[model samples]
Target chain A: MKKVAIGIDIGGTNSAIGIVDEVGTVLTRGNIPTDRHSDINLYIDDLAAEIERIIASTDVELDIQGIGLGAPNGNYYNGTIEFAPNLRWKGVVELTKLLSERFNYPVIKLTNDANAAALGESIYGCAKGLKNYIMITLGTGLGSGVVINGDLVYGHDGFAGELGHVCVENGGRECGCGRLGCLETYCSATGLVRTAYELLGKSNKPSVLREVVNTEKLTSKLIYKYAIEGDALANECFRFTAEKLGKALADFTTFSSPEAFILFGGLANAGDLLIKPTKEYMEANMLEIFKNKVAIKPSELPGADAAVLGASSLVWKELSK
Target chain B: MKKVAIGIDIGGTNSAIGIVDEVGTVLTRGNIPTDRHSDINLYIDDLAAEIERIIASTDVELDIQGIGLGAPNGNYYNGTIEFAPNLRWKGVVELTKLLSERFNYPVIKLTNDANAAALGESIYGCAKGLKNYIMITLGTGLGSGVVINGDLVYGHDGFAGELGHVCVENGGRECGCGRLGCLETYCSATGLVRTAYELLGKSNKPSVLREVVNTEKLTSKLIYKYAIEGDALANECFRFTAEKLGKALADFTTFSSPEAFILFGGLANAGDLLIKPTKEYMEANMLEIFKNKVAIKPSELPGADAAVLGASSLVWKELSK
Candidate 1:
């Protein structure tokens, strides 16, 4: 019988479930609407049923190993998801305890989506054999997972590695966290569009982005589309984003001196359009000994399978331990 | 026979040698001039002789366990002192290898002085029983050692925890490291003097400090004296230094969420004058989750014996591991 681990990605809108084997192969996948179930017990029941249905449909004889989850505010230490703003389940939800009771599984690991991505990258992706590196997810808000000496830094509380919240411009931009000049305010996917708007307001530069200015349609994807086509103002937005991220990365080097920084999520898909300038600015701002040492690379995990693979890798990591 | 470890604290001017037992008592102590010996071999020979003399002077029968060193720019991985600006040795000096060979001792550990302080605090000082904390030494230049999960964060390379070089204000002050606006440039013993000078230059509201302004007699000690005596400008210097340090500590909290920040060295000796304002500013600048969570306290290690004790603790830590 083939041993398999359950991988679940809990998003605000929907939850993705996948049965993954030892080698990161997703055998069967399914999804359920997370927003529809306001009640915690019903949500867990529905999730359990979905997993059972997926397992029953699979042809191979499978022995279930354990379950691993990637959620918005997942705490690895407490096995709970606490006060995630986008999730309907308010306060601390005993996610792992509830799910473990349903499945009767002895091992269940949970961490934030960014830390999960770091584990996946370490176990199966580009960061293999690297003991120290940082995983940065440039999504709606910048999220990060710092790996040092092959273990994730959980800090005193489980809330370490919030690199997105690190101040870059010292009161330049306002953040959702009620802080001034957070790196996320200028470096995330939403931040790219905000940068485009700021560039449009400040200068009379001729560009394709001008047409979508002040509209709800101003998005990072739109900015990337114009940037690839050589729109000067759109390209400048990426440059500005790189400038903030690059400087922040340089400052981060003085703390951990990580081997590399792995970029994940939507903005990272822009490839060299973003990575090239970020590396340049990081090098320019870096201290002497750290210069040209830390590499900034895009995530090597396949975009479609990354979320499930990351979640599954947690189980594999625990088993190996 | 009592088990004792040899502790060597290498400074720019002098080297202090101590023989310490497991319970943190200094059995016998002596010193040698570090600046007098430009040749590395002669320096090693003298240091070895000093250690031997100190060990022989102890009244109790002792078995030497190991020797540990704390020096500027000391690298734990390489066990060498590399490019220490204050030291006469230009390049990487193989101090550990040379000394170990001289003493024929197999176990010799070396790291930067701040890291030693952290190990000392963890083993014997106020930070006992704490698994996570940061050690900040506010000297001529600021130095730091970060502890996470009961172990020091050494990063990928041996050169982790160089928090002194982390920038506070972009392009604000010129640092000796050829960087602009490093934390050390605004918050160290020298930084306090620099702040006092700046305050003196800008505002004429200063009383006592103006007499010593631009003179060689200007020092952090003088500033502390005037501040305690109700000098407004002198107090402002402490406040400004606290502002930069407090904000930087808040940013650092986002990275490693340590339980406490233990302050060491001369500037930190101002007690409530610096700690009070620093805690206030750190709390004001901190994120919601970390607010009122991290304590800012002075180091409990005796000022006279701290260096040697810190060095000796390195041996104890390694042995237990």
Candidate 2:
């Protein structure tokens, strides 16, 4: 019988559930609309049923491991989701407990999506055999997971590794979190678009980005598209974003001298366009001892199913411990 | 038999050696001048002799545990002192290997002084039972040891937790490490004196610090003396230093979210004078979740013997592991 763990990736609009094997293969998967369920218990019941249905769809006889969850503001210690603004359910929700009651699993683990991504990288991706590394996910907003000596840093409050909020340029940019000059304000996917607009406003360079700068369709994906087509302004946006990110990583080295920093999510898909410049700027700003050491690379997880793979890998990691 | 460990605190001018019991009592201790030894081997021999003399002087039949040494640039993984600028030795010193050859010990451990201090706090000082905290030592230069989940963060190369080198400003103050805007340049003991001079030169204020600012007589100690006596310029210096430290601590929160930040060394002796304002500024600058949660407290280790106790506690910490 194939041993499998149920992975749940909870998002603001939709939640993906999957049955994953030990080797990181998703046997079966489905999604549930989260925004429609305002009631926490109703959402939990729907999520649990979707997970069971997905497991039953698998042809192989499965020996069920446990369930692992990844969501915004997920707390590992208490197994609660506290005040996550993106989720429709308000206040604290005992997510792991509610879901566990429906299944006969031995353990249920939950952490923020970024930390799950880090665990996934450690177990089945580029960070394999590397005990110290940081996983950076650059989606709409930036998220991070700091791994040291092969364990995720949960910190005292189970809320460590919020590297996105680290101030990069004090009082420089306003963040949604009501902070000024957060790293995420300049380095996330949206941050790339913001950079595009800033560069578009500054220079009179005739470029492809000028056609889309005032449009609602200006996205990091579009910027990536133009940059690949050799558009000057679009290419400059990536350079500007990478420089800020690289400088921040250099400062982060002083806290934990990780072996590498793995980039994931939308902006990371730009590949060498992002990683190359980030590596150079990081080396330039790093202290002499850390220079030419830490590697900056893109995440190796399969793009479309990365979140599900990360969520399920959490079970394997906990079982190993 | 009573269990004891040898602790060696190697400094630029002098080295202190002590035989400490499992309960953190220093049974007997001695010192050797580190600057007098031009050769690394000669220094190791003298350090070994001092340890033996201290152990022999103890009255009880002691079961020697192991030896732990704390020095500038000490590497725990390699057990060597690598390019310590203040020491008379020019290159890497194999102090642990040579000392281990003379002593028939079960284990020998070495780490930078700040890390050792953190271990001492965890085992025998105020940080007892606290799994997550950071120890900041504000001596001639700023040094820090970050403890997370009950272990010192010894990243990939065992040179992690160099928080003093974290850049607080982009291109502000020049540091001895040839870097600009390092936290140490504005927050250490010398940093405090520098702040005093900066304030003194900025305005022609009628104050006690004005009398000594022109002379090479200004010190953090003198500043503290006058601040307690209600001198405006002297008080401003402490407040200024605390604000920088507090803001830096706020940024550090995003990385580790430690329970408390324990302050040590000369400037930290100001007690509430430094701790109060630092706590306030840290709270003001902190993220909502971390605000009012992390404490800024003075070190609880007895001042004169802190370095030696910290070194000896390393053996106890290792033995428990």
**Shift in Å, residue A198, candidate 1:** 1.2
User: What value of lDDT does candidate 2 attain over all alpha carbons?
Assistant: 0.89
For model 1, name the residue pairs that clash. Answer: none
TM-score for chain A of every candidate model?
Answer: 0.97, 0.98
Per-model root-mean-square deviation over C-alphas? 1.5, 1.5
Q: List, residue by residue over A11-125, the lDDT tens digit for candidate 2.
A: 9999988888888888888999988779998888787778778777878999989988999999999999888989998899999889878887976999999999999888778
Which candidate has the top score in DockQ?
A: 1
Give the poorly placed runs of model 2, Cα more than 4 Å off: none
Share of native interface contacts recovered by each model: 0.73, 0.74
DockQ of each: 0.80, 0.79
lDDT of 2 by residue, B136-236 (tens): 99999988999999999988987898989888887879999888889999998899988987887797888988767677588788899999999998899
**Model 2 C-alpha RMSD to native:** 1.5
